[model samples]
Target: MEQWKKNLAVLWVGQFLVMAGMTMIIPFLSLYLQTDLGLSDPHETATWAGIIFAGNFVTSFLFQPLWGKLSDRYGRKMMLLRSGFGMAIVMVLMGFAQNPWHLLLLRMVNGTISGFNPASVSLISATTPKERMGFAMGTLQSGGIAGTILGPFIGGLLADAIGFRPIFYVTGLLLFLASLLAMFVVKESFDRTKAAAKPNVSIIQGFASLSRIPQLKSLFAVTFLIQFAMIGPMPLMPLYVQELHGTAVNLAFWSGLVGSAAGLSNMVSSPLLGRLSDRIGQERILLVSLIGSALLFIPQAMAGSVWQLLVLRFLQGVFLGGLIPSVNALIRKHTPDGMESRSFSFNSSTLSLGNMIGPIVGGVISGWIGIEGVFITSAVLFVLNALWVNRTLLAHRKQRQG
Candidate 1:
């Protein structure tokens, strides 16, 4: 294998392991809070569980740009080492938690310290040739998606067999292993002296880097809108499945299947889409994906059977797969070569902001309007995003051309 491919494979393994560890909790965390943490009512459980989950992402939103800038200044490998070590420490700490508060606090801490994905993206972008950027990012993201596919299954099994705490321990150990390998073996190619002498820019200065590029502004807008649209369907899927009369025994199986279905589509389609973006242009694929995705949710909104939902979700994933890689491609195309990571970090943070709101909005809409209402809301958001991309993005492209 080529050296970059080999390095990418190694990076993917670490990412998969860490993601697998994290995935185990996604399906079960709400249950854990209610049962293990002794919350008395479903409402209380929902509130606290929602808080815990959303809180973790809050820190992720705050620290992403900072980590991106750090990667730009120091070295990608160093940033990876920091993220791995910090995440391991936090995961281990989470394993020892005695109460919900403890777990929530640990999750927040982990989120703040966890810059693994951003760091990894930066490292890969820094090393990969620009022409191959989308393919590389797609392959790397697929690894994480693969991990996500396995995470719920493995986590569900581990939670059932060994207990949640042990799951944390195992995941922490995996993260630690990933950290060790990253520190010892991963080589840095970017010259820090060159990156550093450029400037000791502040956080605002870092953001200004992105705004300086006109195309980046439109790209960021598309990113935020896509994430916002996509997030609504996720938190409510399991609940929607439950309402369809899915039993506990099969609940994990189907819910996971639904979750994994999109991921599976993403895994299969991401690379292909990324490669296609390289040929046809990132903007075209992104537009197609956004418009297709918005339409997909309409069927989901009207899905009467769990099986129907699964098929729609899987197809949705096929289009959704194009989104990140294409956006990343756009960034790579527009950004100064060495500053790809910093630009992507700003993008990562923007998506994190969308993630932080997606669930809360989904949950509130489900509670007040109806579960199906969430889909309508999602569809509306997605459709709006599609329009925004067409008007703002294509307009910007035409203006630049003239």
Candidate 2:
């Protein structure tokens, strides 16, 4: 196989396994806290669950850019092994947690160590020719989507048959195997002489790179808005459905269906949309996606039945799925070759910040306004973002040409 192909395959497989491991834990984490830990109040359970879950990404949010810069300096391969293998060990340790606090600590540890995906992206991006970057990223992202699609179903079955603890063990083993594959199959192409001769970098200096590019600035702002919109509905969607349906019967099944709906849609449309972006430019596709996302949520807010919500969510998933890969592709275009990982790291960190704040904001709005309010708020954000992108980024490009 060509070296680039080999690198992509290894990264894809590693990403799949790591994401699979993460999925097993995330969807079931609240249940583990509620059932086994004997959490009585639903609100309290939700709070603790949110803390543990969000905390992981919070730590990762702070560290991702740092890791990215390090990958640029040291080697992307080393960062991948460290993040993949380190997270695997943390997942295993989490299985032994006796309380929510313990779980929270383990998650924080895992996040602090997390940098594998960014590392993989940097390595793969380095190996891939510029013309093939979009397809390469789309294909790699598909692996993550595949893991997400299968994870909840498998986790649900495993938790039912054995327990959440056993699921963790299984996840840990797979992650470990992924790390090994990455270690063996993946190779680094960092030009140390080039990096070393470049200007010395600090932690803040890495973040400072964001301000240097207007396109990246626009991309980051738009991404933050879109992600914020997406986060609001996620945490409260199941509860909203159950309340709307007036029963807990098949709640798990329905919730799983809803949760995976986007992944299913994403799987079908991501590559198609990404390819379109490659041809027409990511900015054009981004505008279309934003508009599509905004329009989709209108139906979701107006959904009369659980089935309607699922259908809207599926469509929303298809449109929303294209946004991330397209955004990554755009960022890749703006960033220099050696700094690919660091750029993505900043992007990932910003995304984590969005995820961290999104749920809290969503939950509060849902409580203060209504469940449908969450959808409305999300929709409004998207529409505004679409306008912003058109008026600013697109207009700037035309102006430059003129």
Candidate 3:
């Protein structure tokens, strides 16, 4: 097999393990605060949980560009290992935390060091053939989605069987193992001498250089909106399920199904849409997907039954799967040579920013106008995103052709 193919294969597993380890704590984070850390007040436990959870994204959002610049200077594989191993140590330390502050601090540190996903993306984008970029990004996305879908479920189960602290240890072990696998198996053709030969630029200059390109700027916006729309409604989903189900029995089970439905379909469809985009155009797929997802959200807002919402979310995921891979492919196509990692890193920063803000905005919107309004609002955002794509990407293609 080709070296790029081997890199993709190993990195896919690495992405899966890394994502799974990161998300494994979510199912019982508040429980850990209450039981182990001795937070007596329910409100305090909830607040600490939110803070600790968002702590990672806060630092990650701020520092991703720095890592991106360094990756361009050094090598993407080195950045990947740095993140993988750094996060491994952080995860293990969380298991030994005696207070919520310790966990919060560790999570922030983990975020500061976190770059595994973006590093893997940079490496893959650097190595994969232009024609295969869509397929590679899509396949890689499916792996992460698969991990996200399963992580909470597995975490919840393990939390019951082996208890919470041990789950952290297990998560740390998984990350370590993934790093080991990458260190041994994944091969990058990055040229350190050539990379170092290029003049070093500040992170601000790198961002400015990339943002000057209209296409890349638009792709970054698309990345932000894609994540914003997807993650915004997630925290409210269980309440929405309860509303639709109109009962308490099996509520957890039904809620879990609703949560995983879109991810499951997304995992199935990303590669398919990616290959299709390769034949047609990434921009076209992206625009159509934005529109399709927007329309689906309108009905989801009005869904009267949990079953209806589940089905709509599943259908929506089919479209959502196309968004990121297409964005990544287009980013690679448009980014200037020698700036690929920084470009991808800036995009990752937007992603982290979206993840950090989406839930907060969603919660606020839900409070003001109910959960349904949040859905309608997200739909509107997607529509705006589609228009942005049309103006920036598709219109340019026509202009060049003409």
For model 2, what is the error of residue 233's alpha carbon versus the real structure, in angstroms, after optimal superposition? 0.5
Q: Which ten residues in a row have the lowest lDDT in candidate 1?
A: 244-253
Candidate 1 yields a Cα-based lDDT of: 0.81
Q: Write the per-residue lDDT of candidate 2 for residues 197-255, one digit (tens) a residue.
A: 88867768766766577888777787788778888788788887887666758987787
How far is 315's C-alpha from truth in model 3 (Å)? 0.6
Cα RMSD to the true fold for all candidates = 2.5, 2.2, 1.0
Off-target runs (Cα >4 Å) in candidate 2 are 34-46, 399-402
Whole-model Cα lDDT of every candidate shown, in order: 0.81, 0.82, 0.93
Best by TM-score: 3
lDDT agreement of model 3 with the native: 0.93
Question: Which tens-of-lDDT digit does each residue in 1-402 have in candidate 1?
Answer: 665776687789888977786666876888778667777788888788778877778998998888888888888888888889888888888878778899899989888887788778777776777778778878888888889788878888888898877778888888898789777767657787888788677889767866977778878877887787778668788888887745757885687678678889998998898877777767778889988888888888788888898899999999989888788777777888667778888888888888877777888888998888888887787777767767766677678789
Give candidate 1's root-mean-square deviation (CA, Å): 2.5
TM-scores, in order shown?
0.91, 0.93, 0.98
Model 3: per-residue lDDT, tens digit, 17-48?
A: 88888788889999999999989899999999
State candidate 2's TM-score.
Answer: 0.93
Residue-level error in angstroms, candidate 2, position 264: 0.7
- Candidate 1: regions farther than 4 A off: 30-43, 243-252, 367-369, 392-402
Q: For model 2, how big is the CA root-mean-square deviation?
A: 2.2
Report how far residue 39 has shifted in candidate 2, in Å: 5.8
